[model samples]
Target chain A: MSHLTREALARLVDEMPDERERTHLESCAGCRAELAALTDQRQALATLPDLEPGPDAWPALRAQLRREGLVRERRLPGVAAARAAAAMVLFLAGGAAGYLARGPADPPPSLETPSRVAGGAAPVDPAVAAAAQGATTDVEASASEAFMVALDRYMAATDAPPADPAARLAALENIVLTTAEALHEAPTDPIISSYHLSALAQRNAVLRQLSGDGGPPVF
Target chain B: MTDDELVRRAKTGEEAALHALYRRYAPRVHAVVRRLAGDDALAEDWAQEAWLRAFRALPRFRGEAAFSTWLHRVAVNSALQGLRSRARHEVRETVLPDDQAGPPESPATLRLTLERAVASLPEGMRQVLVLHDVEGFTHEEIGEMLGIAAGTSKSQLFKARAKMRESLGSREMATEGKAYVASDA
Candidate 1:
């Protein structure tokens, strides 16, 4: 038998050999060896294990999703309302604390020319600083409130004991910690805000699942 | 739930359904990205990008193919785009010459050797070999994904396999030599 062409061998490797080439393989020792080697190579290639992302991969991807707005940032009206209420409460608490800490006649600490603005020694307008501080406080409060409400709702919704109470608690704790961290680093970033909100919502869903009211944990 | 059901919910912006889909397919997607990018950091970025792109494009996913297939294609595209962009700015790293000359000792060792060889292949050849041989994409599909003709894809695959065979052959010899030296000692 004539020697098989390299093209023919390549075709055989690709599983596209013609009828005549298929017949050639039966009687040809050299071609058979070549074919076997190729098959082995292909098999070795196929058996390469799929690589796994790090265990924290889902949280990273979830953050990306929130940044992209693929997942809803604002899940529930109640959650939002609770966040707002929480922000208001935090503002009031902070204001009262400031008032009590200051002496009765300390002149209310000059609203017009208080120190420490970014990049310069220029005094910030009291009104602008108050607004900025209020916004920051609101964001922090919203994140905190959202998490608490979600946790409270989840606790109320579940009837039976959780299947894995430790894991459930760990997940809740993680959400709280991650939200707190995000708020501390980038309190005003919408992406961080959305991520904070989503984490709470995800925890609520898990709680619902544990309580038998929801379907499954998102992760 | 089936991917179809999950996809439907994901289209409506359901976070749980999207998470379910991600959980189901992320390993496969990460594997493709890792093989294509040949660097863990780049692979992670590419995998994340692929998922984001998939979700953004979800509404247009008409379900013509299996979700896995569609997602794989998306990953391939994502990797290819990153490669193209990187190619434009980054200097190509030189792949070390293959010097070993014997058969591989075992299947497991051969697999590890082959992975190293594949990672060292030139970007174009590596992409063709991976898509064709490892991922089981057809020359036509690879051509479409890489924006090359089918014949070009075939040519690249052939060159890639030849290089892999040479590299693996050398590594096999090196492994045997090491075994012999250890035994003699």
Candidate 2:
């Protein structure tokens, strides 16, 4: 009997041979050995494990989405929103106080040294935490979390008594508003631009002090 | 939700649905692209690009085929396009050196040897071998994806298997020789 060709064996490994080919294979030792080897090779190929992409894959994709305008830039969701609203209120109130404290021709009060807030960390929202965990971009997530922590600490600090309370409050409010605006425009930017956090914390410290809800200063 | 539902929602610009779909199929998509690209770095990029293209084209995906099948085709196309582009700058080179021409070290290591050998294959033959032998794509399907005649796909698979056999056979002999030396010692 004529021997089976390698092509025939290759096809046989992928599919069952026809009756004629099976009968020939039943009697052909060399063909059987070739078929066995090909089968083994195919099995080996099939058993290879799937590989994991680097851990940064999802975040990289998310970054790409932001670049493509597919997704909005990520922010520290719940707490950041609350902090921003509080900052806005303090800013507006400070502005009103500063305006009222100044005479029409009085120069703006000299800027006070920024104060810091200190306290136990606020609980991160579970949903945001879960999202960060699933993101597998822990480094990026942790940096955002750290910034939020700093902002929280600043918000909690005791406010020092201002020599000019109205003007000091007004300046703090301006800083809060400006920082909030910058964060709103570029939430991811704060990861690289930490000054915004410092400014926000300073305003929070002043607001806390004005409200008589002071904690220790972080800086 | 069903894949169809997710695809529909994704088409309507629901990013959550798109992410769900990605999470579901990314492993399989990455596996296919990795085998096709034969490089981990290239596979990740190709897999991501494939998903991006799939997302951009989701509206046109008329649910005639299963989503996985369609995604596989997209990944294959992405990998092949990358290979073709890279081929322009790359000089063709042999996969094995003269000194390492022996058979695999042992039967236990045969699988690893075969995997390395497959990754070392020239692009055309490697695609055919992987699509047919590993990925279970039919010659007809491979031909459609690779834009060649089915006969050419078959011819390539045959040549690919022959080269693999030669390389593997040499390794097997070398392994046997190593055993003999060890036994002698």
Candidate 3:
């Protein structure tokens, strides 16, 4: 009798053979061995390890997520958020002190804002678009930090001590609203811009803390 | 946190929860799509797209199946859809390198050879083989996924295995094993 074809041997990896094939396999060591090899091959494929994508994989996917609005900007933890707020307040306070000491010369230079290119109006390179988006997020985050600092200093100067998280959250929210108005008028004023960012960052932190957003209790 | 809690939180647009899920399953997701895609470049794109689809469909995910199982289905569908779209645009074939040097002796070399051989299989066979054998999907499940009959899936799998046996230079290995078996007996 002819030996089993390779395809028949492969089928035997998963299926029972016909009587004729079973009889052949009973007497045929070569075909049985080949079937065993095929079975081993299938097992090997199944045993293949899960592959890790490149290190930049997450970042690339995150960028896509951001573009698609699936994931929001990551939130800093409570301590980090508080520390960041304090650092911003100190930096802006120093700058404000210097500005006061210098008696406030002519208005500060206009910050460079990337012009928003209208879709279909021009062919914008993807890299440039992504860079612009990142820059905008950075600018917004900085403006938020500046606002929080300005608001905190304003509250401190006014002797309005926030008694609890709810009170502080309310105060931050109020300041954020006022700062937003101030920003609308003097969009480029360093002091107003700083106040806007400070309010935003503080409000965000308070909201995050209240929501128990994977941060420590305080922010 | 449990996957259910994460899935619930993720449905509410929680970035941290979404990130937690991604970190847990990215490797598995990447593996399935990579095998289905059979090209590293296409695999990355398909895997990313699969996550996008999964996240987008999060709100509709009822807890009937395990999160991993649902996510796996999403990944497989994404890769298949991508392959179909590419097929509409062009027809490309990968020419597998000749293994004229004989069976690789080292396990690592053999593994590399096996992977290359799988990647070089015809697209239909590769998809069925990957879904049924590698990913452990049942033939019926694969039939539903690929929009093919279970018999067709079985046929494709058998053919894929036979082709892989040839491509992996396994005939020589089997012969060697047979010799050892005879000697031992």
Scored by CA lDDT, what does every candidate get? 0.63, 0.61, 0.67
Which docking class does model 1 fall in? acceptable
Docking class of 3: acceptable
DockQ of the two-chain complex in candidate 1: 0.24
Per-residue CA lDDT of candidate 3, range B105-151, in tens?
54555556667888989999999999988999999998998899999
Q: Report the TM-score of the second chain of model 2 against its true counterpart.
A: 0.76
Give the per-residue lDDT of model 2 (tens digit) for A161-213.
32455455555555555456546655565431354565567667766776889
lDDT of 1 by residue, A1-219 (tens): 587654446456766667887788777777776555555666667767777787877899898888777886543233333334333222222222233233244432221111232112544433323433534444444444444544433333232233445455444545555455545555575544755665576567656766779575354
On lDDT, who's better, 1 or 3?
3
In candidate 1, list every pair of residues with a backbone clash: A158-A211, B100-B170, B101-B170, B102-B173
Q: Which stretches of candidate 1 lie over 4 Å from their true place?
A: A1-8, A15-31, A74-80, A83-219, B91-109, B170-185
* Model 2, TM vs. native: 0.54
Q: Is the docking of candidate 2 incorrect, acceptable, medium or high quality?
A: incorrect
Candidates sorted by lDDT, descending order?
Answer: 3, 1, 2
**lDDT, model 3, position B102:** 48
Just chain B of model 3: what TM-score?
Answer: 0.82
Model 1 lDDT per residue over B28-129, tens place: 999888788876678888888898899999999999999999999899899889898889787344332345323446644544566677888888989998
